[model samples]
Target: MKNRRLSNLKYEITKNKSTLLAIIFLTLIILISIFAFLIPMDPSATNTSNILKPPSASHIFGTDELGRDYFVRTIYGGRGSLIVGVLAMIISTSIGVAIGTISGYFGGWVDNLIMRSVDVISSIPWMILVTVISIFLKPGLQAIIIVIGLFSWMETARLVRAETLSIKEREYVLYANSIGETSWRIITRHIIPSVFPTIIIAATSSIAGAIMTESALSFLGLGIQPPTASWGNLLQNAQSNLQSSPYMAILPGILIVFTIYSFNKVGNVLRVYLEPKVAER
Candidate 1:
């Protein structure tokens, strides 16, 4: 099953050159982030003479006001940025899947109550909510993860709930119920698998959202604090220096664009791949 799935995924990627390129580029970025330590110079190392230098042989991306290497900062920044995004995605997805499963698998006062709660949470302006929450939670990695994860799960929940509603009415579901299978077993064995495509597609977009949110919060001085490098914080520091050293902002900005665009493209690809009707068109 795993091999067959891999084969299908390979075929799907081959069918779309853009998606393949996204995968390859993203893979390279991720590899750099993973092996960031391999880079010769430390990202945080300060050199008074090298500060504000343009992109060159020794310092590829350039240098910041603090004389820190922009290339190293950008590469190392990917680690924290991607980790937070991925972590937030996992937390949100887990909470969403659990709540959605319960809300969807069991319809009644349970669904109504849970769904109403979801409505309340989802109705608020998300960024304002995040800011308000950040004020109390303080700015850091864990706090950012929790806030983003908690708030962002609503979309996934709704999707999962809707998918569950449709799936529970299927013939196999009724058969499982008729055979006296436990609710947990039925949801775990049957329903969850059916809804996984929705989750995967949702997840691709959600990670990108998380990355943006984290960057925004950090940029506003409400997320990852200084001395720590995230794409967002890197951009934050670059703002004041934009006129004098535009590359400070430009490099990280380009990276953020590349990363987010890749994720979005990957999400669209997954959506088409999972939906046979869409893929046909």
Candidate 2:
């Protein structure tokens, strides 16, 4: 499996150099996030002497309005963005898998009830729903994560349900059912594993979505909040200084775009290789 994974990755990289570059850059970003504590720069500490400084020898990415280091803040901000992205993805994927598994495996009144709920939720504009929810709740990491997770699971639920419905009809699943395997056991042990590829595709897509949503919310002053460094909040803070300190906006903006593009490329690779339909296409 390990060798196969490497070979597959090598093939993917050879096929799309963008995917290769994306992986390298994303790996560097993740490493930076992990090792941000060791970096000797402060995001919140103000330095009026260096205010509005452009990219220079001392401050490579320059300084912001409060004279804080943009380079360090951008690096540290990645940690938060990645954390929220990962946490929201996990929460959404968990809820989606559970609801989809139950609805697909049972396929009765339970399915109807859950599917109806999904329909109702899907009927609403997702962004409006999330914005409204954020407005009702306090704007912070926790609130944003919960809102993104809750609102984003619908599509994953639908995908998982479809995959489960197809997988549950297979001979192995029917045999397991005949041998007196409990519904829960069969669903957990058999159905979930079968639909895992679909789940992964959903998950990969969700990471970028979560990051973008968080950024949009923060840009609107509804996510992560000030003083705390996040890509979104950084962008928010920089909006006023676009003319004087364009690096403040450009740095974070580039990071966000690059990160999303990387994930998308990686996800595309996963979709083509892991998904049979995609492979056929």
Candidate 3:
């Protein structure tokens, strides 16, 4: 089964040019972000003499208002953005899987209560909730990540709950229950493994969502403050220079769009590959 799944994934990668390119881009960017510290230039270091310089041989992507190395700053920004995405995804996935599993495996009042709460939360505009919560917390990468992760779990929870509902009804689950296995054991062993594919796809998409959310918050001045370069804050810093130094804004905008697009592309491909019914669509 593992081999067949791997073969399917390999086939999907080989068949879809966009997916392949997206995977390659994501891989390259991740590597760049990881090794960004090795670069000698300090992203935050400023030179008043070099401020707002246009793209040239020496300063690719041009200098920002602070006269920092745009190239280095952008690389560091990618590191921050990717970190927020990954950490937020982990937080959301852990919360979502736990709540979803409990809600679905133990149906009746528990399911109804949890589903109603999810519905209530989902009914509110997501951005409003996140923004309000963000305002209360001290602004920084950690605060932004926590806000995004906490609010971002609803969709994942719903997806997992649906998967759990189906998986718990399977014969293996029934057999486990009949054998007097603990509910926790059954859920951990059979249900979680069965629903894990869904979690992977959801988590992939969650990273993109988290990144976009962070960008929006930062643009609004409620996220990653100055001195720390995130793609979001890079764009935020560029807002005043749009007319004078369009590349300042354009570069970060391009990064945000392309990074989110690549993540979404990968997520969609995984969904189609892992869930054959989705592929049929």
Candidate 4:
């Protein structure tokens, strides 16, 4: 049956090394996000007595300048980062997939208009755009997510559009069209499914970019406000004490590096597995 074929395709995709890695990375992050909520330590609690204490039996990651446990803050910080990343990805991918689907499937003036708009948006420097937006809006998690999501969609749009165009030209697509299937039906049932693998790949890749953007925004003091505990904001606070307390900056920096690296590794694996030549080989 059609359902069985679709299930098999999904199994093959999931069996891919890249897909497995991505799944693991995403799963770990999700679990961490959940754990942040369950932990006992107060992310914002400040105890001057415990300030700058090195990692010890009581406070594993040590306390910050404000005497808040770094471990607790890091976990709480992951909440914001992961939430923003997920929200931004949802927004970017939705907009990208929709615009790309419409443009590629319909083509003609629609394609020209969509692509031209994308080019115009893409020409702007993302960081500058984010900076401008941050200046006007309150510096917070939601604002950063919105700004990054808005600017990051161009790449996804371009990638999805290209995939859609190719899928629309496939023999199965042509056969469906020849059989007088409705345009919407063909696009939804056939075109979208065909391009989904590419979209998944692009979305995974974009998460790393989003995390970095959020960090940059936080580092510039235009990102998440004080007491929010983003990795970027943590680094911003540590800049003044980097010489005396290098551990302050190093901890968050290492987390950001590891997080981005994990996502990139997963994305690379997915890319390789999804390629036709790799499958052929």
Superposed Cα deviation of residue 160, candidate 3 (Å): 0.7
**Which 10 residues in a row give candidate 4 its minimum summed lDDT?**
272-281
lDDT of 4 by residue, 1-281 (tens): 45654554466557656556656766776798787877877899999998888889999888889999988888777777777777888888888888888889999999999999999988888777877886788889889888888788888888888888888888999999999999999988998887776887778767877888888889898888888988888889888877767888888888788787777666555554455333321
Off by over 4 Å in 3: 1-3
CA-lDDT, candidates in order: 0.87, 0.87, 0.89, 0.80
List the candidates ranked by TM-score, beginning with the highest.
3, 2, 1, 4
TM-score of each: 0.92, 0.93, 0.95, 0.86
Which segments of candidate 1 are over 4 A away from where they belong? 1-11
Model 2 vs. true fold: TM: 0.93
By TM-score, who's the top model here?
A: 3
Question: Distance from true position, residue 49, model 1, in Å?
Answer: 2.3
* Error of model 4, residue 93, in angstroms: 0.6
Residues 1-281 of candidate 3: C-alpha lDDT, one tens digit per residue: 55665667787789878789999999999999999999988898999999999999989878999899999998999999999999999999999999999999999999999999999988999778866886688889999899888888999999999999999999999999999999999989999999887898889899999999888888888889889999889998988988999888888788899899999888877766676555532
Which ten-residue region of model 2 has the weakest summed lDDT? 272-281
**Candidate 3: residue 156 lDDT (0-100):** 92
Residue 253's lDDT in candidate 1: 83
Angstrom error at residue 135, model 3: 4.3
